[model samples]
Target: MRRFTRPKVIPLLAKKPPSQLPHLSPIPNPSLPQPPQNPSPPSPILTLSHTQNHTHLLTFIKTHIKNPPLTPKTLLHFLKSKLHHHPTFTHLDFHVFNWASTVDSYRHDHSTFEWMVCSLANTARFSELGCLLSFIVANPCPCSDGIFSCPRTEPIFRFAISAYCRVGRLDDAVRAFDSMRKLIDGKASVVVYNILINGFVKCGEHDKALWFYERMVRDRVKGDVFTFNILISSYCRNSQFGLALELFKDMRGKGCSPNVVSFNTLIKGFFREGKFEDGIEMAYEMIEFGCEFSSVTCEILVDGLCREGQVEEACELLIDFSRKGVVPRGYDYYGLVEVLCRKGNSERALEVVDELWRMRNVPSLIACTTLVEGLRRSARIDEALEVMGRMLEVDMVPDIVTFNCLLQDLCNLGRTEEADNLSLLSSTKGLELDATAYTILASGYSREGKKKEGKVVVDEMLDMGFIPDLATYNRLANG
Candidate 1:
């Protein structure tokens, strides 16, 4: 206790060591030996897993089945439960099912199997669908009497064959029909042959579609309204409007009433060949035949009339149709406006534009530009400016075309000051003044001997990233 008291009395002073601390010695590196590397294990052959392959098989089946229509989700669930974890079940499962059930289920349920067959054929997977037909040929489904029936005996098979033909898979479709014929002991029905003919027509294989028609007549497949409609539509689509008209006559001669679709197709075909009057006549004929004119028919009439510079007639027709409570749906009034404007009748065109606006449909940028250009060309500069202002007021920003039109009009009218002001406004609004607009302004300035002003405009144009064209450059150089 006395020593501690004395140490405390010394103010607890500690001794100072050298400036640097002692360093520890480094350890020696150990020499570690490397182990021998073993050869890599052989990679497994990467076939699809059972679940993945089953999913693909189900997808294939669902794709083929459209009628007794099983969706992909339903088919996947069915396969998961029915073919569970099976490796060999590819797209051929449904094919086997269709064939086997056909023979066994004739007495149990004929309609259900037929429905399945029709559904399978409508699926775009022709190759997988062909598998079903092949299975049917090998193992024919039975008839109502419980006797094994040939594939041709089933109407569903015929429907499938026809669907294939419609989609331009004519060769495979023909093979299916042939298989059915052999199975049915050469007793193919008129309905089956008609389907094949219709398929060819639908696929734009007009020649083949027509060939099938001839074959049907040769085989005495009863020509009905359905048969005529298909062939007529095929001719119309193939630009053979005259042939389509002839077919229409033939149908009427055979006491088959021409349906609205037939009339519409003919009218559209005529319009396609630039025969507006003929198309209009067909529309009239549709009404005479007690076939009500659809909106599509009205549109065809309107488009044809407008294209032929008879926009006044088109507008009258539209107004008349609207008054008659037959407002044409999906009809473009913009096209009408364009045709009218192109004919140098922008005032009449504006009437159509106003009509569309009232109907809550604004004309497109193209129609707006066309109208403005027409107004300018007619020396109606003030009216064109008013239209541009109205467009902007409607929150329609002026595109490059709008600016070009306005600039040209202003320059043409010797209003270069206004044009220059407008160009500045365009730049401030982030609207790029194109080379045409610049050239117009530059030429206007140069023509008045305002060389300095023209050079300033040229510099501004270059600053705005527009390279003046040859005319603009020559004018600046000559001036």
Candidate 2:
């Protein structure tokens, strides 16, 4: 109380100087409702109703959006969500939508538009794509930048071209591509050009593809791995392996490294053309390029080796593949087994069967048949019988050819009783004992000077509706 009463009410010190006072923005009107902070998800103006008859889906689509304009975006969405998803829908739906126009929509989103084009193109709906394209040409969508450019248009257009190409509609594809050129200002994308090239390639129109490829380079579109791959594959498909290899060299010369697919294509082409040496060499080259040989590559090598009577080498390769913890593909075993049997390498063929068994992979019907034939060819009658017994035990019926081969081998080895038992088994197994089987039995009896048995076999053969050939008749008469 001493100085409080008289304490001068000195002016309160300002917490912040007027010069340093934080400038406050005036608050906006709180009364006005704020616009939505985020955009609403787009609602489908058109909803699909399920119907048993697919024509109803088309009818529903047509009725809801009369004169519906088609664009790449709309087409893409429709294809992905509607047409592709509902494959049960009638072709009439595709036909109707294919012809629909996208002109009603004043502005179409570019990505959606591109997707639609690609979708239609993918489905081979060229006629419908063509109609939409005509609309685009007449009424180009305006650009936001006011430049009136259509960069996205080219991709969609290319998709249409590819579709046309897929259906062997080369003329249509060409027309679509040419029209696409008019839409974009600068150079079209290499990807687009490659699509056209692939179209040509697919139709076995290699010349056309090559022509377009040259044009692509001339138009400054850079060639890529896919471009070369398409050309190589096309060449190989046409059995023009020489031309394909030449192109491979040229691709490398142009600084493009050959990919595994490229090499694999070439190897397959060589093998198909019976250029086994070249195929094998390319396989080695593939390994040198640090590319692991695929099962297909291995199959080709094994097949080539077998064809050249190198069954031992083929078997070794199979063993090596197994040791590397690689299960031989079904084709590999089938090829090796067939060749081994054909070349009278039954022992090796049996070893292969065992190896496949050890690897827990069952031999194919072809492999089994080949093994049986090989055993018969090499006069391994007992082994052939063992294989047949195993086949029956495993619920596998011996094919007619395999059964005939085994019967002949048994008769030739003077195992007439076993051959007769096999005949009974064949009839029981629903297999016909054809002329070959009876001929073998007749020959075996004749060689043993059992005229009564040989004559009985001949009468049985005639009763079975098989007309014994001169060779069989002569053998029986001589006995």
Candidate 3:
């Protein structure tokens, strides 16, 4: 579920951008692409002069290109800064890109080619993107003028293929890929194959993804870990967990080691089919394979077992993970504690938190608070007090309400001395105390018959404005 964040692009031309732009040599008289067959089709570029906006575009192009025989670099700059970045003329980039080819000496290099492609793809202008790709095929880069094809060519098509895949235009993607394979000097990179496979999978064409993966293999392209991960996920999604597992084994057999994601996906797949034991085993295997844990990995294991009413087993597995020292520092165990507490196994929850904390897997603040409340409800005042102290030692203070409640619990258990020490310690850790905190401590000391201690707290309370009225102040100090 990795979300792809497209880089911020120009404002308007995202409609259907090319992963690259046109260079002149491909086909003689390469006409502009026909607009898509939908309502409100874009005005054909040749017809731009008929519209009011075309006047501005024409003027801007004329103004920017006073010098003849435009170089690709200069033209790219003008297209990007003068038009791409223009507030009013941003969508007019393709027009100028085409117009630049008409210049006698101007030739589109990889730079303008890439810019135009990205612009078309960003705008989701697939049909135009296809034409642009065709134009590139007809007029290969100047570097390809010698025996070798342009190195930049594959990258441009790769970007274009990914863009096509993004829009579910797999045919266009495959067409672009085919054209690229014909032009590239050697085998298509595994990366290119992966994009198409992943694109097919994302578009819900599992069988096609598999077909493409097989083709990639036949091409003798060494499939990387990502290749296996995608197909593994695809098989799992198709209810072919057996195949997913087979691929998992095949992945390792091929000297492509499984990473955390590899294990996590299968573990999750196992759990999705209610194969809890298998899921847990997959997690342990992750550790054995030297793949470090992600927080989500732990979450999946814990949540899966808990769903099956194996809460204690979940607890043991996590403790084992913590002891194994594979738990990522970013992995938070709050949900486990919260679940255990809600299940009335507060002691087990406390044990889990304590064991992990002892190993320096500091429980998040909410986990500490939840565990403290769980302990409080069970009348485990001593453990609650100790948990509170540990939280402060780590500079994690509870909310004031929880803090006061714990203090009150300590006093109620005749541990007022411990309560007072805690109050002082907590303040140093940036735990703000209120009238209720001081009042609770003062009352605790009064019950313990230590007037001197009680008076000290009362005086402090008065200085801090907790003793609001004269009568309350006198009552607190004299108690």
lDDT per residue for candidate 3 within 316-348, as digits (tens), equals 998988898987886788888998888777899
Candidate 2, which ten residues in sequence have the lowest lDDT sum?
5-14
> What's the residue-level lDDT of 285 in candidate 3?
73
Tens digit of per-residue lDDT, candidate 2, span 1-479:
01112212111111223332121112234466745655754221122232344346545455444433445555545655665556554333433332332223324445655655665576566655776676456545444224546567776787677678768888887888887777677778888778788878776788888899999989888788889999999988887888889999998899988887888789878878877768767866776677665667676678767776777877887666565544535544777777667666789888878776667666776677778778877877777787787666565677777787777777777777688777777677666777878878888887777778778888888777676477756655566
Model 1: how far residue 231 lies from native, Å? 1.6
> Per-residue alpha-carbon lDDT of model 1 for 131-162, expressed as tens digits?
55664554444342233353435476677776
Task: Please identify which of the two predictions, 1 or 3, would achieve the higher lDDT against the true structure.
Answer: 3
TM-scores for the candidates? 0.50, 0.53, 0.85
State the lDDT at 124 in candidate 1: 65
Candidate 2 lDDT at 32 equals 65
* Candidate order by decreasing TM-score: 3, 2, 1
At residue 259, give the lDDT of candidate 1.
Answer: 74
Scored by TM-score, the top model is 3
> Quick one: how many clashes does candidate 1 have?
6
